[model samples]
Each structure stands twice: as C-alpha cells, then as structure tokens.
Target: MLQSLEIELTSNKKQQPAADQLGFGNHFTDHMFIMDYSTDNGWHKPRIQPYQPIVLDPAAKVFHYGQTIFEGLKAYKTDDGRVLLFRPHKNIQRMNRSNERLSVPELNVDVVIEALKQLISVDKDWIPTAPSTSLYIRPFIIATQPQLGVAPSTHYQFIIIMSPVGAYYTEGVNPVKIFVESEYVRSVKGGVGEAKTAGNYAAGLKAQEIAKEKGYSQVLWLDGVHRKYIEEVGSMNVFFKLKGVVHTPALNGSILDGVTRNSIIQLLKHWNIEVIERPITIEELYKASQNGELEEAFGTGTAAVISPIGELNWQDDVLIINDGKTGELSKKLYDTLTGIQMGKLEDPLGWMVEATPVNV
Candidate 1:
C-alpha cells in the first residue's frame, strides 16, 4: 500500500445544494484529493485539501499536447446513510489503460482507490440521498511539465474531485433521440478512441453540436473506416435487443470498454439471456427495425447508467424504436443496476465497496 495521505480541512464549507436541484456536475464538495508525479519521485505528496483552482504554467504539456485522462464513477448514499462505490476498481484499471494509450504515467490503482474512499469519507455529507441522485467522482491525470514539446511530460498531477449530481442527461433515464453522424468521425482504428482522454471528447464537439441543433440528445457514432458499423453513442456504449437476443458493438480498437456495458452483459448472462458482441451495421439495424426484429435499444455508461434510445435519425431516415418509449429490457436492467447501486437489492457480484467513515 502507498503512504497515508495528509488531510487538510477547510474552514469555509459552502452551502449544500438541494437534492432536487443537483444537476450533473454543477456543484462541488469542500475537499478534493490530489497527488503529484515525477520521474525521480514517482507519485508522492498525496493530500486531501480544500477544493480550489489549480495553477499551471502557460506552456504546460497538457495545454499544448492534450495529454489528460479522466474516469467517472459514483458514490451512493444508502437509505441507512452508508456510502457505497460501485465497481470502483474496474474504473481505476480502465484509467491505467487510458494512461498507457495516452503516453501518460500510470497510477497506482490501489493507492488511488484508497484515496477515493478517504476523500469521500471526509465529504460524505455531500452525497445526495434523493431518488436517482449520487455523488459523481471524477478521477483524472494531467501532464504538468512546463514545456512546449510534443513529448510526454516528466511531471504529472493526479486529482480526484467530487460533484453532487442527479442525472447525466436532462431526460434522466427517459428515452432520448439520437442522430447518426456520417460527416465527422469521432475516432478511428489504432487511434485514441478507446482511451478516456480529453482529445477524444474534444474531437466530438462539432458533431455533438450539430446533433443538438438538429433536436437530438446525442450522436450515434459509426466506425471510422466504413462509417456504417455502429460504434457507440456520444458518451455511452450502444446496445440493441432483437428477437430476445441482445447485441452491442464489440470493443474493437476504437470503441471504449464501458463498465456499465460489461455489467449489463454479465447481468443478461446471469439471467440466461442471450448476448452477442460484434460489429453491428446501421443497415442491419434499420432492416431489423422494418421487420420488427429490433425490440429494444439503449446506451450504457456511468453517467446515465442506462439511457434508452427511442429514435435514430440516420441521414433523414428516422427509425422509431419501441414506439419512441423506454423498452422493457431497458427498464429491467436499469432497475436492477440502480437497485444494487442504492443498496436495495442483494449484491450477488459483490460490486459495492463500502466507504469507511472518517471523523470530520
């Protein structure tokens, strides 16, 4: 295990927001976890201090080369006032994968996980107890070396920030309309698509902006090479259920391996439902919709958990799924997952990690 982190309490605690008004990532807690990295010292100076603005050099490598990675997970306040983190280790592992891909220094997963537990314990009161509300945890790393070169930075900063968020999308588990992008591609094979890096999301702003103006909630991205195979939705992994069998795009070189997507697949198999992971083309999906084979469709991610895709507009050809409503399977998966998350259901997979309470 890494060294214990130094705790610095803040005297000024901001007024907590009402649970009903806690939208996604709008408010922050009073404290944050931070650690520094260097070639000589490795990762050191782990501390939990007041949440404040970070100062960086003008020519920091992160600003010039876009060398930053982030991971999202949540801590739920159970009915009994206990805080629980779902599948946090998996998120840290994925962060390491992103670091390797982005040429950033990998973090000690065990150390970071402990830091998260401690930080959340300190700010446990910020976890919202309202329905569908939780504290969103953002763990990120950035290259901080003050240089204007293309190479990876020798200095780095790993930080964990918490936000009391309600839902990622305004629809909040309701069905959402998606527009297929044929003009701009998000990422390509052998690119940083699989990595949870800022550049990947930055590259998608144009297409997302266009889709929003077109009255769509998100964009359904296709494969970069063929521009026909369905890769993923804007921030979630897409899934389709046809003829009682679930289908989701395989984790090819470009697509992200989502934790929620993997959990859904495991849940389906646990219930003996058929699930397949492969390259699914838009033509096949449209044909299935026409033949009534497409029964349900949804997207999985940490933010929304399971967002039902009610309609897909591809090149002006709109495909309304399940009568533009949430599907049965989608609702079931959402309930089960959220149930386990909120401590209402039995955790058969032992996915919940209890955050030990710390005296404030």
Candidate 2:
C-alpha cells in the first residue's frame, strides 16, 4: 500500500439534497484533490481544496492543442456501509498509458491511488446506498502552460473530483439499440482512439447525436481504414456472443481497453468460456444475428457496467438480439459483475479497494 495523502476537508453544508439525488455527474462534492506538474518541479503542490473553478489562460496549450486526458471509476458503498473502489490500479495504469499518448507527464501509480483515496475519504457520504448507484470519480490531466505554440505544455494540473451518480441506463438493465456506422470512423491505426482523451469524444458527439436521431442508443464504431473490423461502441467497449462463445474486438490501437471489459474477459475465461479477442466485423455480426448464432451483445464501461444490446439498426435493416431481451449470458455476466461491485459476492479477483472510513 502507498502512503496516505494529507488532505484538507471542506463540507458541502447547504447543498445536501443535490448530492443525495446522485443523478450521474450533475452534482459534485465539496472538496477535490489537485496536484500540479512542471518540467522542473515534476508533480508538486498537492492539495485538497474546495470544489471550485480552475483559472486557465486563454492561450494555454490545452486550450489550443487540446492535450487533455481523463479516467473514470467508481466508489461503492457496501451493505456493511464500507466504501470501496473497483480496480483503481487499473485506472491509474490506463491513465498513465493515456498520458504517454497525449504527450503528458505520468504520475506514479501509487501516488494517483493515494490521491483518489484522499478524495473519496473526504467525500464518503457522496457514495450512494441505493442499488446500482455509486460515486463516480473523474481524474483528469490538462496542459496549463500559457503558450500559443503547438507544443506540449510544460505545466499541467491533475485533479480528482467525485460525483454521486445513478445507474446509467434509466430503462433498467434491459437491452439497448445500437447503430452500426458503416460510414463514420472513430480511429485509425495511428490515431489516438485508444487514449481516453477529450478530443476523441468531442469528435464523436456529432455522430452520436445523429445516432440518437436515428433511434439508436449508441454508435458501433468501425476501423477507419478498412471500415470493416469492429472497433468499439460509443464510449464503451463491445462484446459479442456467437456460437456459445464470447468474442470482442482486439486491442488494436483503435479500441479503448476498458477495465470492466478486461475483467469480464478474465471472468469468462476463468469459467472455461472460450473468449476470443479478435477482429469482429459488422457483416459478421449481422450474419450471426440473422442465423440465430448470436446469443448476446453488450457494451462495458465504468459508467455502465454492462449494457445489453437488444437491436442493431444498420441503415434500412434491423437485427434483433436474443429475441430483443436480455440474454442468459448477459444477465449472468451483469449479475456476477455487479455482485462483486456491491460486495454481495466473493471478490475472487481482488478488484475491490476499500476506502478509508469517515463519518459525514
């Protein structure tokens, strides 16, 4: 374990109702953890200050170059009232990988974890007790050096903030519709698609809005070059069940390697399920859906543990999955995953990290 961080706690005295709602990232806790980085000073000036707006120069490198990266994870309040985090180290490691891609300096994994622990320890009351609800932690890095040049900023700020959030899907754990994009592409071989950067999502919003207008919940992105191999769904990694086996797109530069997705693959493989990490094409998925071989499909992310895909709208054609209901495998996977998260089942994978207890 790393050394615990020194924090200054500030309570959100008046706005208690907003925190109680936990409707995703709408409300924030009173305090946040922040650290600064520079080429000379490295990472310094760690503090837990009141949740407030950050002042950045108009000519900051991040403002122009868009050199920013972020990671999302959750803190869960168990039935025993103990708060815990699910695989935070995975997020830290992935954030470092994202930093390397975005030309940002990397923080030590232990330091990142300690910073998160400090933030959660100060805002433990923000962790909701409702079923399937948790405190979502957003940790991000940004270039702060005020330079108009198109180079990486020498100064940076890393911060972690907490938001009490409800379940992502309001329609319960039911199935969702996906729009297969044969036209718009998300990432190419040399692109920054694998990194959790802000620009990637900013570029995806237009397509996502179009998807919503077309009666689809999310867009299933394909490779930019070939436009054949499936990459990932919007903001989530995708999994396909065919021939009683699990198949997902390989981590081939364009896919975001989700912590939940990796965990599900490991869980399936542990149960002797043949889980293949390979290139699955949209045509292949369509064929499987038509021939009754497609058993299940779901998208996995920190926000949405697992969202079952009930239908796929590809242009004029429609493909239904498992009779347009949550399949057996989808239910089992979701139950097992959430069971471990809510502390109702054994955490054999040792993914849960209990937060330091504090009375609100």
Candidate 3:
C-alpha cells in the first residue's frame, strides 16, 4: 500500500467550459488521480497529476481481453462554496466489487476515497454550481500487462478523471420512452452483469443502438436466460409503483446492486412507503400496466437520480405510463435527493461528504 500521495500541479491550465454548455463527459478537469499496480509491488506510485492521454502497449490485455472496471460519481458545489460528494464511500466499495469480479486487484477503500477528496480539492473550481450541474468523477482500473494470454494481467492502472457536466434532464424530469430488447440479451446469472465493467457496456451497445434507431431513449434489458424477468433498465436499477406498493428487482448476481438503488429503497422505507425487493416478470408488469394497476415506473442511478418512464415499447406494443408524464413520487424523490446532494436539504441519512481543502 502506498502511504504518501505525490502531487504534481499542471503547468498549463486549459480554459474552463461555461456552465450552460457543460455537456456530460465533454470537458475534463485540470488534474487527475492515478495509481499503478503490479503483482510483485502491490499498489504503488500514487500521485495527482495533469490530465493527459494514457499511453499503454498495443498488446495490452485490456484491449484484447477486456479486463477493466470503472465507477462513476459526482461532486457538487454548495451555495457557500463547499464541495460535497454524495455517498462517495458507497461508490468506492462498488469499485472494489467490480475489481474483484474482473480479476483486478482491489483498491483500498479509505485510501481511494482520500485520493478522490484530494484530487477534487486540487481542482475544486471545476465543480459546477449551475442547477443540477456537477463535476462527474470517473475512476477506472485497466489491465495493462501487455500479455496476449487469456488470463488476468499482472499489472494494472487505476485512474480517476473528472469532468464537469450539466443536468441529465434539461427541461425538468420528463419521462423517457424505453424499448424492450428481445433480440439482444444483456447478461445472465453467474455472469459479469453485476460488475461495473467495460465488457457489460460493450455488450449493450448493439441493443442500445437499436433502441436509439427505434426512437427510444434507452433499452430496458430483461433477464438473458428466461427473457421474462426484469433485470435492469439501461444502466440503472428500475422500480415500479403498482397499486400502492413499490417493487424493485432483487440482486440476483446478474443485476448491479446500484448505490442509488439502495439509497432509494432506504429513503422509501424512511418515508414509510411500502417497498419490496423480489423477482418481477415482464409479463406481470405488462399485465399490471394493462389493468391500470401500475401507477408509475422509474429508473434510479447516479447520473439521473430518477428517470421516470413515460412509455415502454415491447414488440410494438407501447404502454404509456402515468399519462406520459413524470409521477409525483418520482419528482419528489428527485428533488429530495438532489437537494441533499447539493447541501440544500437536511441529509438525515448522512450521505454527503465534504472535500475540504488543506492548503494544497
């Protein structure tokens, strides 16, 4: 384990992007966090340096075998100029889970969280203060051993990059239409679906492309094997409000146990709302939708917080939900979560963490 964190400030800084034009993942911050790992030396050479392109060998294992893991989070600027991180510890823990599943070396949770704080502090000005805007943080580990063998690489690089992004939904939380993918299956049980890895996303690109062509915002993936059970909605965990109960799919090794998903469950419980976690079939959901039992549907994740589902197209049958508008509960949840995240509301759950500067 590396104890000392070396800091190298950038000699030349680029012009910052205007908050209004700060699209998602377009512009990067001035500095980034990077750490190297090897079988013999363990994790070492932790440093914060200028954001630049990484140089890896042409035969790197990540390029050939797809051994990489990543995690996404954000930092918010409060009215009083304090930088806040929402549930950053949860993301750090998930990053290690992804590393374990990808055969990559696990990161020290505390040290990695500290690295995030220090890195964000170094470039704290990059955090946007516009409405629903934030500095997106991406931490990833890639197999860099330049080996052609179909095995875990002996070397890895853990890197953290920051990008200032605007709100996910510009004109309020209008629901998005989802396309149910019948041809392409995302992941099955005992697969890498649960991990935040690059391969799982790579596998979804075809389906996503198809959905985009069909005039849908994203693809709602069902279970790969049975193709009946609802697994996840795009990159986020899904929820359906049927009758008066809220139902979300259980973590069955094939679905990502999202941080936002867990937080939403907790919040519902805190609010005394009936929430259940179990296997839900697509047919069941469709039947409920047909009978007008399904009141609202939404997807929860770090990016959108709450993306309400206005319609679901399965085999050309479009099921309009909540009158093709955002639900009241979805709006409330989004408002509360964003308020807490931006240090505007009382975080009774203690989810936000401040990245305080120490005269860096």
Task: Tally clashes: model 1.
Answer: 0
lDDT of 1 by residue, 229-266 (tens): 99999989999999999999999989999999999999
Q: Cα lDDT for residue 188, model 3?
A: 93
Candidate 1 Cα deviation (angstroms), residue 333: 0.5
What value of lDDT does candidate 3 attain over all alpha carbons? 0.91
Off by over 4 Å in 3: 1-3, 169-172
**Candidate 3: tens digits of C-alpha lDDT, residues 84-107:** 998999998998888888889988
lDDT per residue for candidate 2 within 66-139, as digits (tens), equals 99999999888888888789999999899999999989998899888877777777777667777878888999
Choose 1 or 3, whichever is better by TM-score. 1
| Candidate 1 positional error at 61, Å | 0.7
Q: Candidate 1: worst 10 consecutive residues by lDDT?
A: 1-10
Off by over 4 Å in 1: none
Task: Give me the displacement of residue 98 in model 3, in angstroms.
Answer: 1.3
Q: Measured by TM-score, how close is model 3 to the native structure?
A: 0.98
